[model samples]
Target chain A: MNCFKALLLLLLCTSLPAVEPVKLTDDGRMKFTPVFVDGDTRLTFVDFENPKVFRLKSMDWKTREVKVVHEAAPAPEFDPAYSIDGNYFSFLRTTGGLQVSLVIRNRKSNEEVVIAPEPGFSGYRTPAIAPDSSQMLFSFANNFGQDIFRIDMKGEGRTALTGTKGINIWPSYSPDGKKIVFTSTRDGNYELYEMKPDGSEIKRLTDSPYQDIRGQYSPDGKQIAFVSHRDGNAEIYLCNADGTSVRRVTNHEERDDYPTWHPDGNHLVYVAERDGSHDLYLLPLKD
Target chain B: MLNIGSFKTKTCSGIGRRSFLQMSGAIPFGLGMSGLGMVTADEVDHVVAKAKSIVFVFLWGAPSHLDTCDPKPNSNSDYRGPFGVIPTRTPGVHFTELLPKLAQRSDKYTLIRSHIQSAPGHPDGGTVALSGFEENPKPVKPNFGSIIARHRGFRGKLPPFFSIANGVVMDGGRRIEAYGGGEMGAVYDPFMVGASETGKVNIPALALMDDVNPLRITDRRQLLQQLDSVPRTLEKSKFRDWNRTYQQAYGLITDPTARQAFDLTQESVKTRQRYGQSVFGQSALLARRLVEAEVPYIQLNYSRHVEAITPGYEFGWDTHLYNFSLLQDQHCPIFDRAFSAFLDDIYARGLIDDTLIVCMGEFGRTPKINVRAARDHWPQCYFSMWAGAGLQTGRVIGESDKNGEHPITRPITPLMVGTTIAELAGVDSQARAEMRVLDGGRVINELL
Candidate 1:
């Protein structure tokens, strides 16, 4: 009986996910919209330099060296996304007075396509590039709540993906490109939902009373990582691709948000606030 | 006028004569000197004082009244926005889902939804909100904090009035003209201090003496010993005055208890965690410390700038665009947690009875959703949260229309806010008359 109990204790301890997260950056500045690029050798993210400037920065994953991705401009740019082949990049740039335009630039041609809202207090948010780089998905305010919309590579052929009664945002395509997962408040309170590429057969992924946002598919498309506030404060949480077996990844009292999946399916890189200092950390997960 | 002299001296910590004098210049003893000459009123009528300290939490950018405390669940979606209303601890009082924590703590504070501002734009609105008067008429009035600070006079090492923020509050590039002493002259300007999310307190005036980092110095006695070596080159009487200024500066810089009051590290790990580690959160904690230290007034700012999405600006409550998104993701979460913790701490420390706390913005956002699906400036109606200071609690003080477009009940003006604050802080009508401040201001009788 003692030997059996010892084996059970060992199994339980080994099965528990690793609670210790390794700190990656120590500069302690606010960072947002982190994405892995260049075959996972570099990380691209937005760094807020001041209230008037947000610079897109790329870090060499190996040496930890950081550099700006673009020359300084008057308008602040953020919410960056890159095409799967790295041939195209998309981001939101503020024009003026609550107006933002989604700019998609083709690296090969240095040509750009811009999608802006009608003149007034309007802007696009969180552009997600399709896997084939043929389309871009973003959210805009419509009919009193934000709705997801997709535009082709040339910023044409706009189509409403999901028009709900509440906010529907942070849409990203699965690796396979057959389905899209996003956060929505249609049912009241932010929750994760998935639907086909054509916005059909929508299915709820999370049912938390609090917010569950920033959902992203793992590189291999088997898992999803997101930020949820169900456990009191905002923390990183993970669920299966089909939204089963949800588990909390971070338990800190401070906020842990903006979770982006590492190229490897077993880890996530997220912005974590610890002891009042916000920095990026690599959190490992157990199957 | 006393001429500042050039005297060479060095501290044990290697602070040179230039740095020492620079540090002294940052002390603002000249302002305090002027304060000392003001005649105290011999027979002024004084209101029964309930609060010893006042924390004027200035939410710089106006927040939407309908989306927050005055949620109109019965209204159309255009007016109600995306958030659902949640029941608060106070019966029939409801807030949006974005403020669950504050909703649960409703019993701790009174909510006023019938407040209105005189100005629509940020700079003018901010001036009106802080000083209870418009700026265009010239000779802008002193801030309520300034009025209270002058009435109380200087009594401690810490400045009687402190504005805890990154810098002077601004809207775009324009600074509110009535941010400080106003007509009272710069001498009565509240001392400026900035607190980072990590509890790193920065005295901006002290930054003039960058070479002398008083915050980095742990040994107060050693620093004081080093300061004693300055050469006394002036005549005996002049030297005596200079020495008094020096001692005042030294007392503020090297007083361990004074320094400790600004130190967030002195707080336990759990305590700091409760504040949630944001700029506004840590600043709220610092304001609580200032209150505990008996500072007469603290202007705790939410952000330095009014624009929420503008680069280089901290996120303020002005939600002209992406109002619902910003409120859901950033402003509301940070505010709900930090403010709830602040209220809990104030009550836990038994400071509620003697500390008057007022949290409000310059104005409120538009009741009707704008063309961009966001809210814009609306001076017609707004809301404020009041607690502590032995006042009533767990009740709604005023009412707004069903659309939150106008105050259906008696409109509470900014002057009424200033008058009520002053009344609670013991600045009665006679004191206001004597100071030539808050002219024709009347207290919100319903609050009393």
Candidate 2:
């Protein structure tokens, strides 16, 4: 999708002229879990699990219907981070031990490249593809705390960006690909931190005694909308890239968390606890 | 200011790091309480004689000297770019049109047209500028402001030092290092105030009413706390220190005076309009009010974030290819107007005489335009303008080459500038400068 189109949809959320949203498509599959394939047009996410059959169903926004984007993707996995061009989709694959497999299926030739040729990495899951899709960032454990590491897609080298002794997870990159914003349990609570992709000049974006986790930048990187518990509940908070203008977006009695903005930013998918059941909900942003 | 009416209050915020304020026998800001109960009324009412407040306008990114500070009229177009040079009041001195207002009021301040730092990167430049030390080979250093808050405390309940407009994280890897006290501790850190969606200065901590019955609540909570403690008094111990800070913090949760300082309502609509309604300008106005509240220092980060971040909002002064357009079309317009308004307003309000305003970035923009027509970081040469307080002013103390590439005259060090600030604060220049990472460096003697 065009950055403008996606953000135009997202722009309905933030009318500020400076921050145009990265556009995502409005396919009519009751589209909820939006994992970008590329642009605002292509999107795929888990949808419609037949309770009788108990099987995962997939939907593609580009086609605007419940189509077979992929057949047998597993459970405990969602939100596939597509490549910048969105020709491929990579999600965490659980096979024996938890491993992240990049199921790179070229739409043009209908060819696929699975990075995980075999089973491994009980820890490596929730893979985040870089914009260029040349590398992947995810969480892992070692002597240091549960930190996020980036591995080259071509299997060249795996580099750990957040080597803090505290837990640093939910590694997400800005649309510009200059900085990385992640959540860290440093200072005795989860706060937000942004740093260069090379892990230099790290800056703290949030300062709270409460848990401030699951932060992601809008497609334009002008604003970061994250889920924070600063307001006595897990609410969606929006702030500028500089960590200013922080405002809460969600204010429901239900538990609202896991917010992923649409490529256009006009909408976001959240895991809200309504009716005593945790289910995926699409919040149609005003934008 | 007298001890007679000064009964101590309780804790403030329980948030980790610096929100834990410790107020006890130790007069906060470390002002020694030597003659306990002996201070007369005259001493209490006496106006604070020290004109030691600080107004730090932290420009994001290194600004391009070739276009803004030092112009090269004779240099090639690619090098000189588009700006035409204009003469200033001082004979033989010139500035780019980017600083038209600053140029007119140049006499009120001193300009170091050619200061040098080694780091060409954002975090490095900020570290060097803030700490008065190179960013290399050291994990941390105390900033000059942090040192001031440590050695000399605030005059009122206001924070000893404060930062307006800055909530953006920069190069420093961990913690809130932008307005920091590296190892000297977080207590000396400046209280942050900026525009959030809620429009409050610092994030609103819980507060209490001034007329609220503190005695009843204290009696009730003190009784409750006593039931849990073995000692009868629950006083005068490390735990008591913790409890007192906790209690004052509790008082802060409800106090109106603490929140009123951040009230934009205090200023009339006309005043707010006079200072641009934009976040940056309003932030500067708030910074002045903070000064009025006796906050010693304030830093206003012009930019929002560290990167090009979104559109139209450049945080750091790192203008690359797109920078010139931003500087011309969007960036410089904000700076020239906001700064001129601040300088003029502060001076007109008579706060300028005591409040020292220092305006500069981590480094200078590249002398030459790059592939994108924007300048990258250049630490080799730069310029800064300082005014107010007792520090010497009206003279351009240093010089850069025709293109603003490198210093041609007095290439002062960051340490000298840091020492210069110490001198203006009435603190022992050499001693306080030593307190900063730029230890042992004497005040910049030439300008004085």
Candidate 3:
């Protein structure tokens, strides 16, 4: 029976004619699991059987576009995070086990460039650009678990902003671009914390026994929509920036988190796992 | 060369005198002190080739080609070893499934399966594998890389020769002649890099940043040379002093190009991920960069940090008694991905035309499985590899028997390989003067 299944799977695949050199441009959505949009130019980050890549295009009103540019080979890039400003984006690349530097992509000009750390540089990953898009923040693992780091926008190098001994991740700067809300394991379980861009202030946003992470600030900088597993299963929760006004927006015993603000505070979108798979879902704000 | 921070053992005068004393002893006491051991030094000469550089990817801990490469699926499962082979771009040739990337580019390399060597132990295997000479009863010989290094130092600013991992490249202590510069001065020893246990390691002497301003490092070097006292590890042998002189050459650590060779960050994220997040993968990429910087020889060591040795290798590849059981689950995965990506990049970037890549273990495993369901060491016959550097590419050089034991076609020896390295390094092994180290050691001529 297993052999039959294997044979059928093989047949279905081989039954197709030889694959042509696919110069893909139109299949932008599926090209990346989470296709990132930037104006008329619809962009997608694809992870092939090989390396991950970010592909950019200038789409028509019909979304028809030409392949404007691509990063070098090993193929489709992964984990690309862009700044609030469309001018710059960053992604992680690995080819042949050597993890070198972070990448900053500019859509205005179709050029993919790397702000690579020199050989022997340590503890760096997942660079996120600030809203103003001048400075970037990322994580670094040392004898301590992981810390947050901010580097010059010009990519001169890196500077440690949060010099603590814990795993600090998803450091998102507020719309005002002054405060950074990130998740950390320092308070034991994962929880949200807000601090000045210099990493001075300390305000806890959520208290949970389970993991609550990927904290993002609202356009008004008053609230944070974050993912949590406080009530048995994973779900999204909203709370005041000062750890007040705790509210459970959606409850179905499913993981509904990774929420992003839509420039307007009235609507927020997030990833949801209803049955078993995770896809994007939106919820209207009560405000 | 500044063996500082180099770990060493307490002296108890175990066997031979300290290398330094040995050097002093080389002088006839009654005849008045002479120079460092000059046992009739000759300018080893040989035909030179345009292939001045070689990038040797030494697969350490002796990877099993039967299961990982040179697969014979048709034979009985026991004799076939294990891991099934896959189709490669090179027709009639197939690699194990672990190496999907390399399988597609098999035509880019030349595989020599029927390598016959005498050493079954690690050091012996390594010696025969690198120097292309058997550990003889008398004076030992230098490794092929060291031999070239002695010819002039690296053709570039970086250490002329460097080793990443052990592979067959190291001497199994009992036979230092294999990897170490035996009779030749220590100046020929390959400079080993990336010794730090943490993946976040500093190249010790090389600068990686484009804005490093180069001069800052030179200013530091001058201070260290003038202000600080550089102490040498006390060994009595002339080779020990030679090693000291070799360390002095590292003073060129001032060269920007040399440091840039070790700068992995300069390569893109896409390139790093393609290689996978493993030591062997990173090492292979660094090797490519070093070669691009014109370092003649580089060895990329598969790490043995003990943090992830067998199961994920953390970079260990010894698969003797636990060959099948451990390899499929642990070893081959990283090797397959990294090796494939490395070869792919080399060809994609057109680096293949200029670089000579030899990827092989010291010796093949026993054809028959042991009681433990693993293959033991069988140095009687094994495989070596050859590609690039003007030699013909795209095909296996020799064939093995049904049991994957002996060679059925053209047999290979150490001399041919030594001769080949000499040809690449522009040395003439056949030249009468070059034969000095051998006092006559065997030189593999066929490899050329």
- Which candidate number has the best lDDT? 1
Q: DockQ, in order, for the candidates?
A: 0.23, 0.02, 0.01
- What stretches of model 2 exceed 4 Å from their correct place? A1-287, B1-50, B166-168, B171-178, B196-200, B204-254, B306-314, B429-437
**Lowest summed lDDT window (length 10), candidate 2 chain B:** B2-11
Say which prediction, candidate 1 or candidate 2, comes out ahead on DockQ: 1
Residue-level lDDT of model 2, residues A57-112, one tens digit each, is 34455554445544564433344666677655556443322233444444557665
Q: What is the TM-score of chain B alone in each candidate?
A: 0.83, 0.75, 0.76
TM-score of each: 0.79, 0.50, 0.51
How does the DockQ of candidate 1 come out?
0.23
Per-residue lDDT of candidate 1, residues A1-287 (tens digit): 99999998766533445567888887655678789886678888887554346678888999888888888656778899988888888998888766788899998999998887777667899899999888889988866667899889999988998974567889999998999999887776678999998899999998875678899998989889888777666788878899987877777757788988887777888887665456788888854
Best by TM-score: 1
Interface RMSD of each: 7.1, 24.5, 21.4
Q: lDDT by residue for model 1 over B247-341, one digit each (tens)?
A: 44465576667766777777776777677656788788888989999999999998973233665544388787788777866678678878998
lDDT of each: 0.77, 0.57, 0.55
Q: Against the true structure, candidate 1 has what lDDT?
A: 0.77
Between candidates 2 and 3, the lDDT winner? 2
Ranked by DockQ, top first? 1, 2, 3
* lDDT, residue B275, candidate 3: 61
For candidate 2, what is the DockQ-based docking class? incorrect
